[model samples]
Target chain A: MTGGAVADNPGRLYVNDKKAPESLRDLRKIEEALQGNLGRAREATVGIELGEGGAGSGVIVSEDGLVLTAAHVSGGVGDDLVIITADGERHDAISLGLVASTDAAMVRIKEGGPFPFVEIDADDTARLGDWVFSLGHSGGYDDARGVVVRLGRIVRVADVTIQSDCKLIGGDSGGPLFDMNGRLIGIHSRVGASLEQNMHVPIREFHRNWDKMLASEFIGEGPFAKKPEPAKAYLGVAAEAREEGGVEVTRVLEDTAAAEAGLETGDVILEIDGEEIEDMENFLEVLKGMEPGDKIELTVLRDGEDKTIEVELGER
Target chain B: MEKTRQSKSSWASARGLLTAAALGAMASVSPAQQLEGPYRLNGSAVLQAFEPLREVLQSSSAVLLDDWKSFAYGLVVSPDGYVLTKASELADRDEMAISIGASKFTDVEVLATDVEWDVALLKVDAENLTPVVWKDGEEVTIGSWVVSNGSTSRSRRRARVGIISANAREIKGSSNVVLGIVLKTEKDQIVVEDVKEDTGAAEAGLQSGDVIVEAEGKKMEKREDLLDLLGDKEPGDILKVRVDRDGEEMDFEVELMERHRVFDGPQSRNDAMSGRFSGRRENFPRVIQHDIMLSERSVGGPLLDLEGRCVGMNIARANRSETFAIPAAEVQAVLERLLEDSR
Candidate 1:
């Protein structure tokens, strides 16, 4: 199988040379890596539908028909879903559960034998600029095209999310993100600022919360689920727009996350976990996704010096 | 080779600093390390791989500045001083400056603009500008590597690399020119069923039950015929509308407005009737769509091929999936027309 090429030499899959391709041979290697993963991913990826109108993508991850998809795609736990495989094979499945904070969900085939599946790279060896491949039933499954493959490099990877440049369209929400070595690394979660800037639920996040998902224990409210106004994570810091870009910390509440993290009042916040913060609005937008107890690193400038402070978020 | 080595080392050092900073107090004794954590490598090390390409392309591009702040990027199309940028970026801004290399020129003049193609030609009274080399007549195969070159917020050249995801294509916008009035065929005659409020039709005293007879000297027997007649016309164009009400024919001169603007709400339900017909017109300039991630300020720059030849001028960040560029051939054609129009 083409997927065996990467497994044959996993050492070569690590792109330690962080430089632009200077020759055709360099590009060919990267292209081959992507194609190899695409071949493997095409078989496991399937178009998922809950009823009339709800559509997304999913990847079969286990031989016993365990599937991984976005939490938003599954909508709610124990819902009946129809999984249409790449060859147009329809299998009845049921959503097990979802981790709404990370948009990771799982489903199990109700009636099935051994299925074509991909292995998750729980090791988290994926790196920035590493060539990654994405496969999904983009624009819904067309009988002519089947699954579409897009190749791009990993842009940003955080504890809860992985960002990549692989362009994803509307029906690709629950697709799989694979590393060059054909190992499943992430699942498509949501679109970021651009099509290239896509958010994915890191496989590591799933591995950490596997027991919860397998037990069908609902962790948080998915995008489609009714919410009871859950308390949001908060940092006791007052921020305002800074003239020199980013947000300046006006005050830090006593004994709160900001105060405990040693964030000073005069520090200008520049980035939150590798994502650039342009202003107060951008800063709030980034904070909105995080939950209480989520540890984040804030890059800030204080009195002509740059410092990175770690803060454990507090509940609102 | 030396430059490549230097860049690699510099990137490695930067990555080291970033890792240390991200780890913060936890760098000395890591939590993931204490436990039997998954074998992992931080992915932040390889972000600076495009620095070399950025350095090369920055020499040929200019930062369009206004009031000491860079607003857009422009491709230096001529050695003496011509710059090509997105026409929309120049909208409503009379005072402009162009920065090439370390020098900035404030005496910039907008030579001409092609609103249909969304391109503008500007000239600066300066010399020694490095003109971009065009990849003329070259086939842009899908999946071929391309780079978007533009100036960063800190006035440094930045490069975003991605594959040519798609070829020349036309996309439709929600807004289209329309003389807002809903029509219904009654007894083989097109009659106005409703005249949208605040629309050109309403403003022109057109009312419901008004029978459309002629438009711009063309006879209208059906709704399609009227739409076909107005298809070639644009917003702000005056239309000599002839209608019959109460068995009496009256003529009204109406100026068309965009359907979305006239409705002043969501997309009109009778968009097919009142909305300006839209789709990819056959005569649109060829464009190359790439998946390069770019902000609005990064657009209007140059899209270069792997060999460092300019393939096109970045026209629009169309949507999430694509950023479009007007091909070099089309840019050259527009440049010639603009030059002729100016002369």
Candidate 2:
């Protein structure tokens, strides 16, 4: 963030400083507001144990044990997990729906109700420079360490993410980010290398997908999505850059397109469908756009002669 | 991996852009937008507004330096030129001095030190210094607004604002203390796999085939039983260990050491991201955990509440989110003991 020129306060506080306190009195007011709601917030924050191995954090949003967490932490729909509450009681839970694009996911506890929960920011009024605090079982939950809290300000706000100065790490993902009023404004996502570059799934995204997530349906697509990625087109040959400007096939696996097309291990692939393939990287890029089972012509250099061969791409 | 690396580089470039934009914002004086957020908190206008208040509270603050570079900070605890600071930060420093405004005091004496609290009492030649005003027994609850100081350069400091992030409690060496022995289950017995060289186990003459029988008067039934015993122990703690070496009961007094010192393993990702931390971070008797981003060197100063009352002394920069401070009541007790020892 750029440090703007210090201008006069013109007898009125800027909209940005609405939450960031400027004076001792205002600071005291924020302290009072935060202290009043801190207990409830702590009670809702929970530790999540991934079935595969690692751990993360989440926040209870409903009394029936609806938890809001990062999509990456929730993994896939119906994935079983153990949720440890503030009092150190563990409950069985299953992953619900998730919007992978926003890194937002929901989990429902299998046991019956009356769980501690915090309210999401209903007004969606969180903005830049707003004072916010986050709670998580950082570095995993320990009965001795308990829940850790961090206070910061929203440094940058994006469409689906809000960047805060609050420092978060591996186990802090899926934790709740709250305003001074103890309203959940975001869910902790991934963290950047810089301490101030922590990303959070904005509360609005959860609000938008509230219905879909409740129905236990996984939605959206991205790297974090539970949906399977499309298969990449395979050429079935381990190739390297030749000294003479073409990709030299080091090895050709059997039962593949290259072996079926009579492309030997020593064949130098010069072009793919008339486009010059300079090296191994270039060959991979051309194949990336094409789907599995696509037929293409390969310009190959066998011995001292250039030959054309038609090959069908295979699934990787 | 590629995406996260790209984002990191982008953040670095964005920081470069921020510097350029900041210069541009300053160069053009056409009623630009008023600064807000962290920069505003760091900027002069807001800092200047709190200058008078901070000046009075920070009068007792002292920055210790070596070769004109700040290494640690301290607070004037008495009118007789006594300054208290984090003890471990001054370890192995031959040339130590504190810069008071424009004056540099090179003849600083290490009057006394408290190993448990990691605090030291130093005496300078000067007298009639403004001792910090401590609010004894004041309730510093979580979410309370707190302030600290960061040293930018020699004798130059900035005000840092944050809140009490966690309840004040005793932080034992839950993660740092270690026996320095690799163990494995051999036929349902917790057998020593390997004893690392120069560790407490090796120092106690523990061999590879020795089976741990007892630790600290407790019988070890499994590997976790020994681990559980070590979890409560701290560095420099003496553990009375008894081992069965080929049906021979051999007893040894072992002194435990820090985990990182014994085994130089990879740091936790969070700790690696948290720039620098105090060498002696854990095992405080009682500490007020706050979210103020003070550097490791900037610790040892006073932590003040919004009312300009000194609540505690900053002791350790634990990680990116947590900075531990010795609470006022505890600081008072340690200060008394140190002063008593100094005499």
Candidate 3:
């Protein structure tokens, strides 16, 4: 901002048909509102600690310094984290706990201070083509960054994910997507590697997991609750997803299962436990429920090459 | 060998005291005080620091320089009167002359230079020249107090103190590599941030990442070190110094380079308005007997500007918000013999 003066080129619209002047003005109002909201949201990123989490973004949701950021940030368990502001003032923070299924975590600052919080819609019904903006971190190492807003229409609303046209990158994950009226509909999560695609976890998932979190000692389930029954059909190898591209084979653990069935890096796993995987989410959820000693057949696309191996799981 | 060894050891001790005093002085300043003036360099310092460099910066035959004196940012390397400046500063000018004491006699000759770091050495006709002083391991660490000696009326020197937030980053827009310490004191510290390679700094084994804590036993926390050293010097000279490396004291000899004029030809007239932004003077740091001195002289001469500051030295600026200075550690090599006899 030039001396805090908002750039005069605001209130842009992206609708399909011709609209009335009043409607045109309304869209402008929405854009500026989102910008203001975005500016406020970025305050968290700047003051967040560094190396605290492997990677994730979040927002404040309570008055007592409780913030809702990605579980991945807290999950890293042993990194030093600090957040900085746009003007570069830094603050140290600690992670409380996380609810993995919905990708949300609760954090609190040691000291109390005023913070910004976004309101969530209770009924869970935001129409398609509605004005939605994702305020997320972007660019190098993605810390102390401001929100890069990519406005788009909502296409699909599922039990867990909300698909949208807004273009997002790695740093956008765990952030929020809001309705122009200031209601939180979903989070700004992952985006497809090839297309201008982006996805998010609807606010309902967060709400659904709220009880489970309150009842349990921590939010998310403990490691490897059960190796899915369908996992037996494919090779049992651990994998992590990439933001710009396809799933990568991070570890083979022990090939006893996959070695009897072979797999390697750059190998794309299409199915796990026989629950055909569409992308990163399908695979992650499958592993979250896997049991030790589970024997599974693996299918892989290694390099331009394709192969498979059956292997039993081992203790981490 | 015994004499040289004893001199070196004494130089080392003096450098150590300078470093300690600087840190102590810096620690006493209040945080609120740092947010305001004294900590904030008056705009004149930026101009004064470059006065010397403007001479050599306008020379450099390796690049084409049209009417060298027209460019900004050259520093004086020798008292016989040699000018040293960045190669890019003279990229367009092929022919240049050294102007001693701003004298009408302008035909000084270009001498040996290191093209890699944009440092060109020149020689002018002058006698009994004065130089900036520097000691081994004498650096202006990240948070040291500094004065930008600029050409201004009423206020001759502008000072700012900052911490050395980062070092070893590459300079933008030029192939020239800078390896020296940086000073951090305020919000607007991003204008320049390095000392050139193989110059007085790089030669004294001062690597880019070393943080300078003091100079000449004058605590960096206080503003006395540099001010006290500048009291003695002609335009085309070098400064010796002491630097703090990884908490250890060391010695270096940095030559004071000159600032050059940026526009001097027909094409320059079209863009003359922008050249005015660089101003008229600046400071270049150099090492002394056991201290670091920051000097700015015009056309490589000792004539002080209207504000009582040495003019025409170039200070390296890094960003829209920060700047750093180069100390003269090697340019004083010619005077090293003089110091040896004096001691």
Candidate 4:
């Protein structure tokens, strides 16, 4: 992360060059701009360990030890965590809160310090094709390796997320994404369909919800947590809605209530609990109101014969 | 205690829960433009930044085309239309064609193919082709700007720029050779468990329960030790194996084949797409890893420096964060061998 510093000429957009560097000096200037911010940002970026789970990357955003990370990495508000800095120093930290919808989270070092931090560019002025650098503990913490830096372009910028061509992997989540000026622009969110398709949470969103995060106001469930759904009675049969007004069982999951009830593929479900099952949607709607262990009589059509079978539902 | 720990990370309020209906509705909503302008450029600024490199590449790079599809990109290595490209893409084609700009030549001949390095040399019946000049031993320090240029599927020139993330190093791949011998631990020594019939081990006179002492002069104390010795050896490679049979040490030459070739419908395509999309394959070897965003098809083209000098040839689009390229020196060495083979 050590490199020579370049002169900071404010108001000069680093990406104004519409062509490749014309000379070695131009190339040196480009290198210097990346190095200057990268050297400082690497120190501010830390590795977050969530006990038994895998590690993630985070950036110290405030001098008083406020750290920003992906909500998925933080897990939940008040979660005890350990943060490892670039120098491999471990610090105790607690998750403050998360904006689950946007996958943004904040944490604070329990032991306060004038920590090295990167300023978040509140304007979020990152445009398409602007040069950006990403630093993270890619492939987790390799003691032999220092903070990894990847230079790429802002592939896309939107209201909710900024997509970049920068390659990110599992351990890179919650890492800092900085513009060419070395300002924090986004937080690494998730990898898209391809390596070039990476998503980041715009720093502007983080600034907008700064107070709520500091107040420990938790938003939706953390990234890894499945959103809580209403308990549904599980017949455990893969079915398709037949055009002729019934749910056709395509496959029955083994060891499930449907399998135990002698449900087989090709069996058309006509009704449940004396309620006519019009289609797959209706069948699902009826089950939503029921719970596991609920006994219901199912009318099924098999080989041109209609038979009612008693079935005990399982929890899903 | 486990339940309490699990609950700590769970949502405390039901209001935040997303019902199945709600989840379905969210999916139905059009995903906010993940990309704008051309899907490839991501933005107009990217187009502008790449214009210069794209202009240089369009003149010096060619599209390797088959009868039906554009398979790969080729870098003009010589003035008289000698091109270099990835061998795998050109391996199974019925015919080879080279496309420079809008002009297409069908009378292209495969000069040589180096399977070990996954590069192919081709000679096109053309003249006045712009050859790319090498930077020549240019040390690509980490964080230096690098640009990858190649022919897109639309036959248009494209370029992606990034920094050198790592120096050149050997990145190992998983598709290794199979000696066809199962080794077992016996009395702190690696013993031959079973040598399948018609395999290199059986052909080399290896028998069940034979204690393996060394392979290719590397002493084997355990099963892992023998595996390490055979890790780098490929199929058809002659291995000088020494084994102890009934207190008698005997050396025998054994040939190695790929492990999966012993059985199976098809050897797993250890191709980049298998790894790039699934993120499950092993890494390549001896590559200069960079952050340039080039697709698998775009590989085999030249990675140019800011001064339009060929720094390397894009070899593998490793993953989301790293692309591998064969350095100029290595590419030059391969091109030399290819020329010799063609002669």
lDDT of each: 0.68, 0.74, 0.39, 0.70
Model 1 chain A poorest 10 in a row by lDDT:
A14-23
lDDT of 3 by residue, A68-120 (tens): 55554444321235544334444455544356544555454434356556566
Docking class of 4: incorrect
lDDT of 2 by residue, A138-193 (tens): 75766655677777767666667676777776677889999877889999876655
Model 2 scores what on Cα lDDT?
0.74
What digit string (tens of lDDT, one per residue) describes model 4 on residues A1-316? 1111113334334433332334446545767788777778988988887755467789998776789988878877656788888878889887765888778888877664678999777665566556678988764554434677887667666676777777776667788999877789899876644556667888987987775566444666544333434454677776655667777887777788988989988999999888998754466568768888999999999998999889999875
Residue clash pairs of candidate 1? A128-B43
Per-residue error (Å), model 3, residue B139: 41
Q: Give each model a TM-score.
A: 0.58, 0.69, 0.32, 0.63
lDDT of 4 by residue, B1-343 (tens): 2112222221211212223243333334435443444423233444464566677788788887777467678889887889998765664578767788667888888878765677889888888878998887656666777877643655577666777775477655544566777667867888778887777878889898888888778887777776777665655789898888999999999888655345331222112212432121123446677776666566778888777888888877755566778888888999999999999
Q: Write the per-residue lDDT of candidate 3 for residues B1-343, one digit (tens) a residue.
A: 2112112211111111112233233324322111111111122222234333333222211111235433433444344444455433443345664333333234545454433233445555665443322334443332122223223122122222111211212222211122233334334211113545534454555565454444544444422344355344422345555556656866655543332332111212111111222221222222111001222221222212222223222334311112333333333343343334334
Residue B293 local lDDT, model 4: 62
* Cα shift from native, residue B51, model 4 (Å): 4.2
- Most TM-score-accurate candidate: 2
Q: Kindly report which residue pairs in candidate 4 clash with one another.
A: A129-B46, A167-B320, A167-B321, B170-B286, B171-B284, B235-B256
DockQ, computed on Cα atoms, for candidate 1? 0.04
Q: Of the pair 1 and 4, which is ahead by lDDT?
A: 4
